[model samples]
Target: MAEPTLEPSTEPTLEPSTAPAPEPMPPRPAVAEPTPSTAPEPTPPSTQRKAARRERLQVPHEPVTVHEATAAASVALAGIRERCTSAPKVIAVELDIEDGRGQVARLNFKPAAGFKAASWEKCVRGELESVKYPARAAPSHVVLRLQR
Candidate 1:
């Protein structure tokens, strides 16, 4: 059998190639093309909503004149007095209903010690006393308390 052999290495070789290089061009005179600036159109204003001039006052309501104020006061007082006189008996007072509608009125009555039914009965009586007008004023309906 024959053996193979190799020659020893020379120092690593790196060399530049001999070739022509390129040249840069000269700058040209600048042309004055107009700048692309744009101006926007102005927005038109909206119409004013000045309130329809309030009907010019023909009658002066200044100071609510004494005779006028007193007249209103007298009428209000008479109505209150009438409501006070027609109040119902306290055996059972209630919030009078009208066509199945009952208005809310707060109760000052409170629960007593050890008896729920008695407290409720007192509440019913107090409700009667608190009403401003008699149940006869509107007898079409009555209060219906529902527990849920």
Candidate 2:
């Protein structure tokens, strides 16, 4: 068996390199500090409503009183009583009144006891038709009930 010869190592060994150092960041300029006020600024009122109510006056006149309406209607109403055969039944007259106009825009008759003649009801309506009320600020529903 032949013996193996030992060899001497002479090559220079090199060390592993580390990462390069980072450059320093430049300093930022000085900024003025904001001074707080004692009282905060007042904000204006917001009108955000999409559908606000109308500001215009509706009827443009004064309101009508019940006494005035009854006074205007009494004479016609009395004629109805005289013609009726029986004691008068309660009748409700719904009147649509316009501002500054004595004339009723519309009339609806609601009778507790039905009238024998449509003509009679209409006659009563006609007599009361000329009745006028004081001017009103808005259109009004006036109901009058009369009984004998």
Candidate 3:
């Protein structure tokens, strides 16, 4: 057998490629100034004063609680029972309350019950008008019916 001869290696060596890095961009501004058109214009003194006064006058308020309303109705009903000659009369009383104070706006009595006395309605109205409600932030309407 003949002996084999060794040959030189022809494969290339492995190495990392080198390249230039890109330049970084500049940072953007944090906030931009408001344009003249975007900004609100100043109003005249008189107009501003009027708007302030109107806003002040239009203060918000809350309605009276159910308990307070019931108390007021009870007081009115008791008064009605004492003065009303027509017992077992059904009547509806409507109250218009402003700033926690109430006044009778309407008094409706069932005509079929044969209770046509204006004095009874007037008396009930007087009693309801005197109802002092709890402090309320707004105006309220209350309707109470009297029966039994």
Cα lDDT listed for each candidate: 0.34, 0.57, 0.66
lDDT of 3 by residue, 52-71 (tens): 88877553466765556767
Please, what is the TM-score per model? 0.20, 0.40, 0.46
Off by over 4 Å in 1: 1-51, 54-61, 85-148
The candidate with the higher TM-score, 2 or 3, is 3
TM-score of candidate 2 to 2 decimals: 0.40
lDDT of 1 by residue, 59-113 (tens): 3323233233223223323333344343223212123333223332322222223
| Better candidate by lDDT, 1 or 3 | 3
Q: Distance from true position, residue 129, model 3, in Å? A: 1.1
lDDT of 2 by residue, 8-90 (tens): 44664475435476788889888756557655665543543322335544554545566666666676667767764343376
Candidate closest to the true structure, highest TM-score:
3
Candidate achieving higher lDDT, 2 or 3: 3
- lDDT for model 3, please: 0.66
Clashing residue pairs for model 3: 61-137, 61-138, 62-137
Ranking of all predicted structures according to lDDT, beginning with the best and ending with the worst:
3, 2, 1
